[model samples]
Target: MLDMFRYNWQVRQDWFEWCRELPQERTGGMGSILATLFHVANGEQIWINSMQGTPVIVKEGVTSLEEAVEFTELTQSITEQFLQSWDDELAMKTLIKKRRDGSEITFTYDKIIKHLIAHEIHHIGQLSIWSREIGRKPVSSDLIFRDY
Candidate 1:
């Protein structure tokens, strides 16, 4: 699971680099590249807050990829610290969250990590589509032959 987390982090970094070649503005109403990247970074932060039972404060006005990268690195550092002391017993523990409609959802710590990873990959698919629309090749999503 830790390996998966590390791999996703590298994949995100590669995507950010690929996005740097594109214009900062939106091409076809899909969304601006840098804005989408910010969304991904913010998603990690929201999830970290959820895991820590803290407030989920959404940031705004991050219009540059460099700013997005900074936010991502900060959130990743917090996640890394959390994982460093993780154990199987904690992974088995579940967190229950109440929805606005008064419904409840439960997730294991391990599953939360998996969900965050999948969330990033799903957005990467969106980035890939927008990249193709703009006549650019996206970073490869392949896991094979990766350095980490």
Candidate 2:
């Protein structure tokens, strides 16, 4: 699973590089490239906050791709630190999250981390599709090619 995390980190780096080449006009606002990428990065931070008993800081307004990359780097650093303390006991520890409707759901740390990776990949696929529509070749998502 740690290897998977490393692989996803590399994938994210590639996606950010691909996004940097795109026009700034296409990277802002709702449903835009940077918006989606920011959401993925923010989601990672949210989960890390929950696990670490820290306050979730909400960042508002439009952000540049460079800023998004910086935020992602920060989130990844926090997550990596959290993972440094990972163990069988920590992996099995469960956390309950309350939804907007006041419903609660339970998940083990292992499952939550997996969901975080999958969530980002899912959004990255959307970026890839959008990239194609704009006549750009998107970054590769091939896992086998990754040396990680």
Candidate 3:
């Protein structure tokens, strides 16, 4: 589990760096670069909050890439802290979350961890596509590229 979290964090850091390097034209869009980063960071927070059974509030209004990077780093740090404090019993327990569309779902800590990584990968893929469409060089996303 710790390995998974570390790997996820590394990949997220790579994406954040790529976002930071995006030119102003590439970063400008419906939600813009900052907004996309906020959405990604908020998604991580939502998963953590759901697992902890805390009140989940959607975050908004991030205006700068630097702000997004700061928020992402902070949230990742908290996630790492929580994982460090996790016990076997807690990891095996299930968390129930109520969706905004009035649906309820249950997941264990292990499932949440996997979901968090997978969800980020999905979004990063989207970002890569957009970057390619805009003629910007996309960062290497394969895990092997980061293995060194």
Candidate 4:
């Protein structure tokens, strides 16, 4: 489970790093490439916190992919430590979460992990389209596909 999370993080980090060489306009929608990265990283933190029934921890004004990566790493570290206390049975327990609009739903921790990875993949697809608009190759999503 943790390995899946790490693979998703590596893909996102690789995309952000690859995007750094391009002009800001290429990734400007939804702010810039850095902001989009932060959005994805922050959402990961939000969902992880929600799953744990903890208050969301937020840091504002992350202006670079480097900073966003650091924040994401920190969030992942904390979340992993939290998860360490749980066994397989506990990890599968359903979590009750509230939507911003006040609706409520339940999801298991594994389900949330699936959602987080899928959400990142969806946004990365947007980044890939943007990259192609400017005639750039999208970063490879497979971590083991490259030496890294």
Candidate 5:
């Protein structure tokens, strides 16, 4: 399961490398690839902090693909360290999330991790479509072929 997170992060890394120079307009469409990427990175950081019983600090504004990749890598590194020391009991722990609208939601540690991975994947699909629409080939999405 954690492997899946790393794999998809690598795919996004590939996307960053592949479309590093894409104009902000193309990448920042309705969903805004950069914004979505920031969401994924920040989401990782936010959730990890939540799991550890700390304040969820969302450092926003990834202005470039390079920054997005770097932020993603940093968050993933912390996440890897956190997961490395995790146990089954930790997976069952719950984290309460407070939305901007003042609503609170709680999720189990394992569920938050799964949701973060799925969230990234959902946006990656959007990035894939954008990549091909611009005549650039998107990264292969097959897990079997993924070397991450």
Candidate 6:
């Protein structure tokens, strides 16, 4: 799980750096680079909170590139803290989470961690598409690119 978190942090940093090189119009427009980043970060937080049987605190919304980058950094820190505090029993235990639409689901801690990483990758793909469409260089976000 720590490895997965590190991989996500690196990919998010790459995306933030790439966004910095884009024109303001491309980076700050509706559904822009920052919006995607914030969405990804918020999704991870929401998932983590749900898996922990805590009330979801991060709200979904659009944000500026700078704000998204900052939020991503904070999210990474919180996730790392949670990972460090997690016990082996908690990692292997199952969690029952209630969905927004009044549905309930069960997932193990390991499964939640996997879903979080997969969700980030999915958003990164969308961000890459947007970056290409806006004439910016999209960073490679593949896990294999990360050392260790």
Candidate 4 lDDT over 66-101, as tens digits, reads 777788788878667766775677668898877899
Report model 5's TM-score to 2 decimal places: 0.84
Encode model 5's per-residue lDDT on 62-121: one tens digit a residue.
Answer: 777777777888888878888887678988988787889999988898888889878888
The per-model lDDT (C-alpha) reads 0.77, 0.82, 0.72, 0.75, 0.77, 0.77
Please give the RMSD to the true structure for each candidate, in Å.
2.1, 2.0, 2.8, 2.6, 2.3, 2.8
Model 4 ranges off by over 4 Å: 83-87, 143-148
Would you estimate the TM-scores of all the predictions?
A: 0.86, 0.89, 0.80, 0.80, 0.84, 0.81
lDDT of 4 at 72: 76
lDDT of 3 at 96: 80
What is the C-alpha lDDT profile of model 6 across 11-130, one tens digit per residue?
888888887776673543336667767777888887777666667765666456777777777778778877887778878989886789999988888888888888887877887787
Question: For candidate 1, lDDT tens digit of each residue in 39-141?
Answer: 7767777877788777876687476778888988987887777778779987887888889999999999888878888888887788788888877888887
Model 3 backbone overlap count: 0
Off by over 4 Å in 1: 27-30, 54-57
Candidate 5 RMSD to the correct structure? 2.3
Model 5 shows how many backbone clashes?
Answer: 0
Candidate 3, residues 1-148, lDDT tens digits: the string is: 6666676667667767887676672553336655665776788888887777666655665777777778888787767777887888988889887889999988888888778778767766777778788888766777765652
For residue 131, give model 4's deviation from the true position in Å: 0.7
Please write out the lDDT profile of model 2 over residues 35-142, one tens digit for every residue. 887888888889989988898868973457778888988888888889889899999999899989999999999999989989877877887888888888988889
